[model samples]
Target: MRVLVVEDETSLAEVVRRGLTREGFVVDVMHDGQDGLWAATESAYDVIVLDIMLPGLDGYQVIARLREAGVWTPVLMLTAVDGEHDQAEAFNLGADDYLTKPFSFVVLVARLRALIRRGAPERPVVLTNGSLSLDPVRRRVLRHGSEIALTPKEFALLTFLMMHAGEVVTKATILDAVWDPAYDGDVNIVEVYVGYLRRKIDTPFAEASIETVRGVGYRLLEAGPAGPAGPAGPAEPAEPAEPA
Candidate 1:
């Protein structure tokens, strides 16, 4: 998962970046609150590590603005102040979790993982659509209890789709959600990754679950021997909507 750390303290930020990178997460750091806020808003970050005190904008205002704008990306607020009132305020402003200074690196990682899981729909880190299950945190996938190996990007794509299972998602939406905004969109990388996913996630299974909407996009449907069936009636005809 990608994590954006908004901190003005140079040494502290470096420590966090190094520690988190070593933990296998893609990390980005910003010294100013406005830049942090923009990156957090524009980029595909799983969790945002925001410090309370900042330049240009304070963490309180940043968090408030993000929540007010309906950005539900999970946030883990960090502050040197350990006051209960401050914690309450941060949570009220939509911070998913909070940590004070002098914290252990391990505890922070644990908290981050816990908060991401809480904010995300996946429980037990296992996403299920019929018998197919992918454990994102563990980077493991199983179909009918059989293990399947998937590359990091393929796993990220599958997890993103499965997380929004049963909902039709557009290519642009998928791109922005699963990839960084800096990614080149002119190429057919999304299609290539989808093909990779199909080869691994769908071919081994008896029935296909990922449905391509010719003009709209793709939807991860339930795998059924009788074909796709859901409460919304027959799956809507596939169509990839114009990129947003």
Candidate 2:
């Protein structure tokens, strides 16, 4: 899963980043409210942590604008002010949860997990495609009742693919969601990780779940045996005329 932390306090932001990274979440940080708002709008994140006092925009305006623009990614408002009206304002502006400063990091993690679970569409606890299962909270993947070990990056990539199972996802989409916004590396890095995943998740099982789409991208097969089931591949040519 991915998280966006929009806090101006450098020390606090760094602390949060280290803690969440240890917990196996791909995290992005923004110092100003405008940057945070823009990042939240442009990218797909599982959850966001926004601090109230900011340089460009306040947390209230940020959350309000997100709601106005229909960006429903869960937002957890952070502020030093603990006034009842302030909390009320955040909720009214569509903040999913609120955390006051001097808060417990342990409690914050728990709250973020709760928000993710509540925001998930159907199966919030685990994401499954066929017999393959992934527990986002536990950061574990299981296939055919066997546990599959994956590096953090590999796990994040697979989780994103599994989240959108059966959909043909483009390389750009994968880069945006799986990697940080500041990543200046080649996009082919996606292919590298995909290859790593295929070796572990598909090669052993003899399952072509993650399939290359030729000129397009890749898809994770859903609910059935994997096959050449996506858009038709290059068509065969007609036979030459035999007339004299």
Candidate 3:
């Protein structure tokens, strides 16, 4: 299989190149993020190994741009930083797998092989409800052509709701999906975030795309809301009072 390794460390890149060549895989190595992005975009490869910190566009930007430009090659990201948020951001930005620095070569080979086997299946790539659009790979959210900034948690919550658009998702389900499964915090936190979403995505535009189902949870309308401030639009059911 063909693999592209984009690591800024020349020694590490050469070592990986040699090791993978010995493992009976064709490997092409690039030493900077810009060169790496160009190679991956300009060539067809089965998979790519990308590093997070690099001169000229970083690994995150490279992956996001690749996905944005319709290059779906599976990417395994390398990062020395071992924070959960970093890993989360990597996946959120279209990384297929992640390996921290000082990783096991054996594990790396195994992961690469696994990604090759999985191949790239073309998913929707963007989630949308009416005029609201969310690009998971780019970590961007847009409403009526205007970008709406969102915190990671809020973005995640909105993604979940859009995924289940038109369905009434319970607070338990929202908590489990958006927050950690073992989250022990108050479930009402979902309500607070939902309110936050409405303020940004709904209220400002005089839209009611997110509907509160009394005694249940919430639902994101599949049709989404009307254009921003265009008209009173159709009347939506009154939202139940948010928890105190």
Best by lDDT: 3
Question: What clash pairs does model 2 have?
Answer: none
Q: In what order do the candidates fall by lDDT, top score first?
A: 3, 2, 1
Compared with the true structure, model 2 gives a TM-score of 0.53
Candidate 3 residue runs with Cα over 4 Å from true position = 125-244
Q: Per-residue lDDT for 27-70 in model 1, tens only?
A: 99999877887787677788899999999778997876565333
- Show where candidate 1 strays beyond 4 Å: 1-4, 8-29, 32-48, 51-75, 78-96, 99-124, 223-244
- True-structure RMSD, every candidate: 9.3, 12.0, 12.6
For residues 146-238, write the lDDT of model 3, one tens digit per residue: 899887677878877877887999998787556643358989888888877887787766667777787898888777354432233345444
* lDDT by residue for model 2 (82-152), tens: 99999999988778899988999999999999988887333245777766787765668887878999886
- Tell me the spans in candidate 2 whose CA falls farther than 4 Å from its real position: 1-48, 51-75, 78-95, 98-123, 224-244
For model 1 the TM-score comes to 0.54
Cα-based lDDT for every prediction: 0.76, 0.79, 0.82
| Of candidates 2 and 1, the better by TM-score | 1
- Please give the lDDT score for candidate 3: 0.82
Displacement of the residue 169 alpha carbon in candidate 3, Å: 32
lDDT winner between candidates 1 and 2: 2
